[model samples]
Target chain A: MAETRTRGRAPTDPPASFVWTRRIVLTLLAVFTLVPVYAMVSSSLKPLEDVQGKFRWIPSEPTIRPYIDMWSTVPLARYFVNSVIVAGGATLASVVIAIGAAYAVSRYRFAGRRVFTVTVLSTQMFPGILFLLPLFLIFVNVGNATGLALYGSRGALILTYLTFSLPFSIWMLAGYFESIPRELDEAARVDGCGPVGALLRVIVPASLPGIVAVTVYAFMTAWGEVLFASVMTNDQTRTLAIGLQGYSTQHEVYWNQVMAASLVVSIPVVAGFLLLQRFLVAGLTAGSVK
Target chain B: MTSAKVSAAGAARAEGAAAAHGAGPGGSTGGRRRRRLPGKALPYLLLAPAVAAELIVHVVPIAVGIWMSFKELTLFYIREWSKAPGKGLGNYRVAVDVDGAIGADLLRSFLVTLAVTVLAVGLSWLLGTTAAVLMQERFRGRGPLRAIFLVPYALPVYTAVMTWAFMFQRDNGMVNHVLADQLHVTGGDRPFWLIGNNSFWALVTVIVWRSWPFAFLVLMAGLQNISRDLYEASALDGAGVWRQIRHITLPALRPINQVLVLVLFLWTFNDFNTPFVLFGKAAPAGGDLISVHIYHASFVTWNFGTGSAMSVLLLLFLLLVTAAYLLVTSRRRPAHG
Candidate 1:
């Protein structure tokens, strides 16, 4: 990796003052990052009343009751399942579709290549709310016309998330694929492999880091999404974002349970992201040039 | 991956190869054009889903949204939005009229969003650049520190914002407990964070914490490209650490920084999740980002026409800003590939 070239310290040994400054800055930044997280985690462990009246650095009576009660309190298990299905489905579909489109852009040039590229790039800048109402109307209309249940279905959420994820994924993956040398794919083609075969065998294996990075990103975006979930989802399809927000709005907000549920929901993605963090760094390094 | 990093060199080779092999048909990746009858249709077939997805999700919806904006499409006409009577500029007029209630409120949210976007993006970039540079040096425990630094980014957005909302509670929140009780920064009385003026900073806080790590990651990737030789040369020429950073590091990172800063700006401006999760449907006046504000205008207020008009204006403003930004940046680096 090009990064290995610059990993070590430069020829000069830094002065003590520079070392101290770096330590202080890094420490301060890390504290800034971790304190709120600590607040959330510590608060989640406290009993209900303990989190309601005052902020305690340490819970006076530490308990896991919030974790125990959070599921029963709001059907949190159901919402978690819904989030997993919707976000996971969306990520899978986006990656699969984006692989084809990104390969098309990076490895071939069609007549509308620049148009498709520019359109996807600019489309990213539009806010989600711009399309929410019309898309809702379209969903409703389609459901009415075809009886497909497009408005309040989990599939609807997946489709909407694809809207959010697909374009950017194509744009990004194309850049990553562009960074990969073209000779490898050519060599595969010469060995009696077609485009799909070359893409699957050579490009796919070589760009695992980029694919994983995009997959995690798309999943996280859908997982925590609030806007579309609020409107597109119904009682049966409530995702964690809407479910937790609804829980917090209930009378006598259960701060502890809400925090507990949030923690439980966050851990999977956080752990997955941390485990794959190195790939993301390498992937972005390859794509960042363009 | 390293073997594949020949985009710059391979282009020269690709041209030579293309000429030698005789360009039968063009647009091949690295080799000369391969025009087998079956291969000719493959790229379009591959791109079909992407184009269709764009049309159905983005292009069609945008066109329909524009049509709705020009009509009196409110809750009354939501079911049959296509039949909503056209009002031409009536919806836009109400949205832009400064003295009118809706327009004034919309203007306030826009300004608030502008301020928050500026502060958050600037601070995130600064903190991220600082951390990336600091982390560039080889040190013990750097890996763990980098992971810890990215925790906010990795954590669910709702989780982080909800934590802030809890922490910013008037009586029970930790912001007051630490700043007032421990540090005595608040004037005797505990100030509210989710409402009134302080909500802006509270909004900015969550935005910066979650997004700075992204900037940090990108800049760190960018920093790896800068050769140590540049730093060594500067050091031998009597340049101090700060001088080397200012002259060598900053200039080396210009291209990536341009892309990073723009991305951060766009993300922060378009961010509805933070404000929505933090303040809920009816965002406070001070922290009402335009995205949430438009959501409120359309959904909460049940005035889709006005909301759609605001959306059009926002889109236009973003496009204009992006065009101007690109033009200025390109002029500065006209030779950039």
Candidate 2:
């Protein structure tokens, strides 16, 4: 990679003072990035009096009470479970659906191929707000007409999420698939493998990193989504984003517990990104480079 | 069992290829054989489910939104929206006329959104590009610094914004405690960061913090794609770092910067999460972003027609901006290519 090459040569190195400047700047930037996060964690541990009293860099008497209380506070567990189910289901469904289309677009040359690709890219341009009213109306009308009970359900949120996620998944997967050489599929064919076999056995395995990136992207979108989830979900099906709103109201706000719940909600995604940083970076930058 | 069926199908395709080759001349036979393949429809079959889903969820809804913008959609008629009375251009007039109540509010929110998008994108791009370029040198703790830098982007949006919300609290918030009490930057009384006129800057601060990491990542990737040889040659020719960046690095990263700026602009412009989480359904006067503005109009006030009209105006404006951007970028590409 160019990064490695540049690092090896050290062509951009400056004087010792400049090095110190860079270190100081990077440190300052890192601190700027971390301060809010620190506040969140420290405040979560602090008692209400300490939080409202003098501000301390570190809590004087740290406790896990907020974390413990967060569970019983406001349906935190239910929101977490609901987020997992909706995000998980949306990710799986979108990935499954996108794989076939991405593979086809990457491997085949057919009529309307360019149009299909352009259509996929164009979907990203439309703002999400434009879709909310119409989709809500459609759901209401469909439920009333067909007795499907689609409104106020997790199914509605999952479906609504696909409006954004499906296009992105398809685009990312197609870029990944394109990077896998066509010769591999030819080799599979010569070994008595059909098109489906070539895709399933060769292409999918070769593109696992890309696939993982797409899955993570879809999951994150569904997980952190607030707009449609707030509108479409009722109390029983509320996702974590909507659930977090319960901590604050017109009258009062729970600062300590909100921080605790926020920390708990952020763990999976941050850990996931740290674990899969390489693949995610590669998959994200693939399309732009080409 | 699946492998057996797949192998059987492969065998039949092989035979078909062979037969077509035998029946036609050499040069054109490959095309003929491909055209005659029994799986010619497979690509379309594979594409159907995704295309169908997009059409139903995205395309159909957008069409419906446009149609609904012209109708009198309110809480009373929401149960059967199709039967709502059509208002033709009445909603559009109400949305855009600057003299009226709804129109004036929409216009104000639109200006606020414009300012927010411009400032947020500009500052984030500056910070991100500088950090990315600075980190290109061989430095100690670069790996750890990179990871630390990405935390803002990697962390969940709601979590990050929620933390910012807590920190911006007037009484117990760390921001005021540090600025006013500790540093003596202001008086002992904490300024209200989440409400009134101050909310705009507060909103901008949180957004810039959350979004700059994305710009950092993209610029970093673009920097990686640039060959080190160009910088080395420029150095040998006695050019300084600033000159090298101006003549080589900037030009090399032009394409990336274009797309990155556009994406960030769109996301920031249409953003609902930051404003929604920070301020509620009805944003403070100072921070009435268009998304929340429209949401308040439609959802809170239950005037779907006016809200849809405002949204349609936003959609058209964004589409125009995007088209203009793409055109200008495409025109410049050939020179670089």
- Which candidate tops TM-score? 1
Top of the candidates by lDDT: 1
List the lowest-lDDT window of 10 residues for candidate 2 chain B.
Answer: B1-10
Model 1's DockQ score: 0.46
Off by over 4 Å in 1: A1-8, A179-183, B1-38
Each model's TM-score for chain A is 0.92, 0.92
lDDT of 1 by residue, B272-304 (tens): 888989999889998999999999888887888
**Model 2 CAPRI quality:** acceptable
* Model 2: per-residue Cα lDDT at residue B42: 92
TM-score on alpha carbons, each prediction: 0.92, 0.91
What value of lDDT does candidate 1 attain over all alpha carbons? 0.80
Worst 10 residues of 1 chain B by lDDT: B1-10
Clashes of 2: 0
lDDT by residue (A36-116, candidate 2, tens digit) is 989888889977677666567787889888898878768899999999999998888888888999888777767887567
* Docking model 1 quality class: acceptable
